[model samples]
Target: MSSPPAHPALSCAGLAFAWPDGTPVLDGLNLAVGPGRTGLVGRNGSGKSTLLKLLAGELAPTAGTVRAAGGVGHLPQDAALDTRLRVDEALGVAGTRAALHAIESGDVREEHFAAVGDDWDVEERARATLDRLGLDRIGLDRTTGEVSGGECVLLRLAALLLARPAVLLLDEPTNNLDRHARRRLYAAVDAWPGVLVVASHDRELLERVDRVAELRGGELTWYGGPYSAYEEAVAAEQEAAERTVRAAGSDVRRQRRELAEAQARLAKRRRYGEKQAANKVVPPIVAGGLKRAAQVSAGRHRAVHAERLDRARERLEEAVEAVRDDDAIRVELPHTAVPPGRDVLLLRDLELRHGARIDGEFEVRGPERIALVGRNGSGKSTLLRTIAGEVEPRAGEAAARVPLRFLPQRLDVLDDGLTVVENVARFAPGATPNRVRARLARFLFRGAEADRPAGTLSGGERFRATLAALLLAEPAPQLLMLDEPTNNLDAASVRSLVQALEGYEGALLVAGHDVPFLEAIGITRTLDMDALTSPRGAT
Candidate 1:
């Protein structure tokens, strides 16, 4: 035997949790994570984040127990930092560092010695951790406010690493990170010596994981390999499920045919008996006895065939349950197409209100799909807003010849008080309710889901509704601009977005940091603000 299986680094038994408002999220779920990187994946609101929270002890379970072999460290989705806290304090070594400094200055207090106990090189270790995460330029004395959001995320991860916890849980750690910062985090995940569970939709990051744990429908499932392996496994499972359904369907048909044949035979026998009795070939008493016997036999034969049919139907139902029926977004915008080589937008030496300047002229012709990429605070959103006419340029002129729409990062296009259909109606005022609902169904909001208030939808649902509102607008949007469209979306929503955009024939300008999403959308060119403003030190 292979030396008895090692104990799980993290374990949870009968893990149940419900909100104070009585909405159950995890219902008596159980999971165990061994040492290595495990990417946790699921649809939005499927409790991937919630289970991480529970495992980290950030939220107490409504029932059951969670146990960690050693210490547990968590990096939440928001990664909040105290702006006034210094880097040393953020790294949780300020106290020991101060004590060591005091001792070096010849203060021999017992408390100082106690605080600096065995680890005399805390600052050096902290610096090494920071350097590994690409924060070598940052000074330990500097305040948190001095760093960008992406750097802050790295800083928080650095703190967790410096602690050397046995178990680490990170939730959507790459949400606001740029490509460079993401690579640094990926390196850390690669070198982790203990259990690391990350809940994310980032395919690149997930590919580095040793395994995958999927949380869905209040239950947990373990896949033995990375994201691609999980995808393959699920695909194989679905194929087999479909095959079972086909076989079950065939069995049901065969059973039904057999029942029909049995009934036909019974009818023929009855006709023969009636003819015999009518022709007076047998005694009346004998005919009555034979008729009763035949009736009893027919009832038993029908019951047996019906029971077999019912069993076959039950098998079919089980097979159907095993097959997933996820719907895809299918919106069509034929009117949004632009003629070849037509000028859709023109920017002439414009200086954006947010301090990013386009010194040279920029033109978007026909249906060119351009990606605006840059580090945070480099004015990507400002450029999109200026193009959308939401912000006035500080200098030159920006013009749009075709109808355009802008979907901000906040997804503020919809009215919170209105239903999804009503929100679509806001953009397409001339369309009837039936027509609006018909279009909404393409966005996967069929039937009563179209009646849900915009404010009550989940993150993914809200994004879909906002997209529907913009795409369904009157005159169609030929020049569509989106700011960080995949910021908080789940994997399914991101796939849906790509599918929707694939069918769009309009000129597109999207400003975001998701490289995978940009590639999936088939971007024809990329505009790097850092390169454009390198002479002015914008980077």
Candidate 2:
């Protein structure tokens, strides 16, 4: 007799899923997530979000079984909490707490007693959970609208924690969170007791995981340790794959040379046989027999060389396929360079209606990179808009001496109806389509991909297209202002963006909550919008 297999915290066997249009996302996938923190990573459009939805029971798989030891809680990439929902209601304990209050007030209905059965300290637990998630000051009666977008995300996570599910799934939990909120969420992840699976591009978040699971082309590959370890492993694997490809390429070349040599020798032998046959150096029957034997020998030799060449070519193809193609953006903008002493932007006591208060003068000169950091609703976006000339400041002057462009958080610069090529052309009207396409190719939109409609592109691809438009515009922008640029980008796209920025020689003002990304892009200084607005309680 054999013992039964142990059940993991969560398991999926031969799972398959497809979109409504019959486009497959995951096919015949098998996964087992034991009790621990696991980081799920992949490129955009790789179905990380869809997989979480299936596991959370929000969507049914097209095939196979998904089993979990206990309840599952999932936080999606876009956690949309109703603005009017109260804190206690969002935590899922409003009914029970209300019942407790009613019972204490001498309204002892049987239903009220039933609602308040065993868990009488629900409010205490809710508050504790909220506190653990860094919402200590938040009142249970307050509505979600009173909090920031980052706070709303943490609030949802607190509710999930209150549920105490056996398995938790978080998708891009740190997307809009500021540094402080992200640190609190990281602590929560570190302290989670159940099977926690997070799909994120945040390097710091991934660093806390016990293991990394990479999903590529509908397949799951498990790597022990954190994101850094996974990157090292991947690098080693790529090195080996490249070596194999080189060896296979050499084998193919050798086989081709051997085949050519055999063909040449065979042709020479045929010519010799023809001459001997014509010279009548032997009897007619002997010459015929000799000619036939030589022909058979040459045919066998040629067939063997041809077969070896075919096999070599196949091996080379397989070797090449094993390597991952990480297409990166390559940009060169000499026109965007600003001299060291040149004034790029000047702001004089700019103030916005939304509590973003800049009481003093600020100027950006040369190729300086500045990070605009603040809590959500602190008017970082408003400040960027004012400098971009999209919004007028109420009390002061916001001016840009050099040519400037703004990349909004919502990516509104693009026209969804038009293709990416058309969008670039709109920004660079003087450039021909061929020239625009050639420039777009550097941003990794090669050939037909450049012709894709902006609406049809994935989040990362759309970012790239928007970036291409900005960089390829007429009289290239000397000052680039980006509002929460890394909000929805995948890790690969983030790296590509950094590389593009490295090539740019302009002044940068990027407002974002991603600290690692800011550091990676070489931010020279930081302006805290929260400090500027603290005196007025604006946000």
Candidate 3:
């Protein structure tokens, strides 16, 4: 059999990086990747993006070096495109360049040059790539400005695919993409040859990679195989580390007890020696020798105890480091009483629209937990807005028993200029300034942070602020509408939010892709948007 290939296509050696404010983001971090796919997993703010940028040659490391063997391509989490240009035109730039390069190098024969009939061929290729990404039937003549955010994402991917770089870096590629687009992306990734590194939180996508590398505290651990294998290995490692710490603790306790007993025995011997000396019942030399022996024994016991304590401390630190704390942000929604006879929400044949087509028709009742599941652009957001009274349905009547509170995916409900306390005050008008500050504190906003502008808060903080306002309302809204509430939340925050939702008896209509979270919060019913809206044989 032939030996496998050697030499990594990309490598970072002793890489160290820091932010402008002097906070260290990466500390002597080193990683290497050869051909094939590698999945990067880490808690939020773990420097995953910084490392990718370094590898892509977009950012310089403060210390050490990153090296890549071939052309590199990066698909940013949020890509900005020329909205005025059509999709074909945007992608044509790269295709044209490659064609020109080939022509200049005499790689194209006369016959091949003749076959390059018109620019439409290039546009066709671009459109085909987009189609493979589930953007089929979308005209190349359409302006990117008119495209949805999800389409923009697919366009970016199409551009990268056209370029066909030797190494690819994708950051959260599945984010904001609908299920169909996600499946398309997975298919493309599976077929692509060359070095590929993806940083994402999507378990389904990660499971497709050949290896999983977890980033924790500026260190990386690579586990061979898929996500499930990595998960099992991590679980076993944690269990072993915990057992080691426990055993060390027990040893320390045993050593302390033994030391105490030794001290007591030494004290008793010393007292007997001292009494003998006082009574002049023995020679002074013999009594002095007895006293010296007791002191020597006590010193030996002390030394032994110190050694055990030192070992125990080392073991405990090892265990602590082995099980690193996940730093994802979390939000806690406080429980509130629901008013009697409050018809939190009422929907009458509510119809949602996507472009000229009707997406779905549905009705919701008070205090219902409904999960909306569909492919991207299936009118989930439109449905939510119609319910919140933010958007009007073309045809149908919608009403809320009480004022409805909507938390968009972006958490834009709060005014960016207002401080955390001020935002909270807007929802709970009767709340005094002090009371507002207290409420914010319950969600981890305390001290002077309450006065900080909402725009300065992190993604997690913004979500918490929104939840705080909703829960602290004067007549607390019995109906809460959340769109992808768990997208940017940390593990801890997700857990807290789940607990709060479990205790909430009011109606909740959530549109999210987090299956575990949905199951945990007890989604009593689900609305399949695709089934309700599709025309005859549309699927």
The CA lDDT of each predicted structure is 0.83, 0.84, 0.74
**Model 1 lDDT vs. the true structure?**
0.83
lDDT of 3 by residue, 321-409 (tens): 76645543234444444544545655555565453233342445555688877766666777788778787777766677665578886
Model 3 lowest lDDT segment of ten: 530-539
Q: What lDDT does candidate 3 reach at residue 305?
A: 76
Off by over 4 Å in 2: 1-6, 20-23, 60-65, 330-356, 364-368, 374-382, 385-405, 410-459, 465-478, 513-516, 519-522, 533-539
Quick one: RMSD of model 2? 4.6
- Please give, for residues 1-539, the per-residue lDDT of candidate 1 as tens digits: 01111578788999998755455678888787887888888776577767888899988999999999999999977576798999999989999999999999999999999999997999899999988987898899998866656677888999999888999999888866778778889999999998899988788999998888877788777787789998998898889999999999999999999999999999999999999999989999999999999999999999999999999999999999889876556646546788879999997888876567777678889989999888755677778888888878889888999999898865777888888899999998998999889888887888877887776565566777888888778777889898888866776667877887887889999888987889999999888876664333221
Q: On residues 1-539, what C-alpha lDDT tens digit does candidate 2 reach at each position?
A: 11112567898999999755455779999889988898999887677888998999998999989999999999977676898899899889899999999999999999998998888999899989888877988899998866766777898999999999999999989876888888899999999999999998888999999889899989888888899999999999999999999999999999999999999998998898889889987888998898899889989998999999999999999999999995656655546778898998887777875556776667788999999888766778778887888877888888899988888765778998888999999999999988999988887888877877776555566777888898788888889898878877776667777877877789999999877889999998888888874323222
TM-scores vs. true structure, each candidate: 0.81, 0.83, 0.80
Best by TM-score: 2
